[model samples]
Target: MNFNEVISNARDSLTVKRVYGDPYEKDGLTVIPAASVRGGAGGGSGHDEKGQEGGGGGFGVNARPAGAYVIKDGDVSWRPALDVNRLIAATGLAVIVYLISRPRMARARAKSSESPSES
Candidate 1:
């Protein structure tokens, strides 16, 4: 298949219906869960000096719960979903950043403290 066709297929698979999911009813209330979808696709073909052909392609898709649409008694409301896994990952990244920067920040502080000042 061509690159465009592959990209189109990826998009088709991540349609609104696939992301938001089907609505279901429970206790006279309808809930439609929603999700955030992300995807990328790329392909390339090249020829070498020896007249050899090379081709490569890559694609990725990620879907995560965003929220849900709740309808009850003719009223509608939105309820958001939280991903603890993402939260933990973010926290870990923050700690790593702080650890990497702490020494630099300390050195800057020390340098400022040692600088001469006029009374």
Candidate 2:
């Protein structure tokens, strides 16, 4: 192509458009029309805006109850049911064992205390 044709083509592809706004304003704070608002998660903190240390609201979508169902390994599952009877039995056995050992432990402690210290 001729030099003039090449220059003209480059100029045609390089048209400039003006953006009307305060360049320093936060993103969503600009007074654009409602219809012009593009849908998506936008209009909060600007790219350069320094957000608060930790002042966001609302629990996240993943927040749930302690025993809530969760998916694992492509399968749905929930916390196991508690066995009240087994828990009670285990607790009772622990108490019995402690009571039975208390006297023996006390006797051993007394014997140790009565023993003379070696030089």
Candidate 3:
């Protein structure tokens, strides 16, 4: 499967819950799988009206609401989003490329080393 599919599958396997944001306020929090954060699958945009027109050849009022998602505390406590497995895979690929190119680099070094030095 592709990267997206892998992330989607991981998201599907997680648990979620809905809880109150603050005991005093009526706002609610929907706690989603932590994996959802990595996949961009949890939050979405909201509507606003302040962004409409441009003034005198200037840029228009570009306003957009930020997406929100709830993260709970645990071994899965929310941190900055990243895919650890993907990072490892990328590092491995880089190592492989470096290994594959090593022979050419070595050949060039040998050629340079073997050249007679100018007196």
Candidate 4:
């Protein structure tokens, strides 16, 4: 397909529908699944010394579950998606932060003990 067709196809496919799915109703609850979608398109055209023209384009997309909207009893609530990878990364970062600050905290504690006691 040509660049215009590719772009048009991409635009149609990459939209709110991709992010939000049809509402599911069961057990008196309505759940609308949502996702995070990101995409980009690039194209370029150039001419060689032989004056031949060539053009190319491509689209890339990344999607992940972001959250869902839950509706029940005329009330709505947002339920955020739990990404295991992100959770693990955050836990690792917290551990690293605590480990790095452990030394400083110990030094401060030592200095406070050395200083005269407050009245």
Model 2: runs farther than 4 Å from truth? 1-69, 72-78, 117-119
| Best candidate, lDDT | 4
Steric clash pairs (candidate 2): none
How accurate locally, in lDDT, is each candidate?
0.88, 0.43, 0.46, 0.92
Instruction: Please tell me which model should have the higher lDDT, number 1 or number 3.
Output: 1
Order of quality (TM-score): 4, 1, 2, 3
lDDT of 1 by residue, 16-89 (tens): 88678899999999999999998888888789999998776767888889999999999999999989999999
Weakest 10 consecutive residues, lDDT, candidate 4? Answer: 110-119
Error of 2 at 8 (Å): 90
Off by over 4 Å in 3: 1-79, 116-119
lDDT of 3 at 12: 59
| Candidate 4 Cα lDDT to native | 0.92
Badly placed stretches (over 4 Å) of model 1 are: 89-119
Q: Residue 39, candidate 1: how far off, in angstroms?
A: 0.5
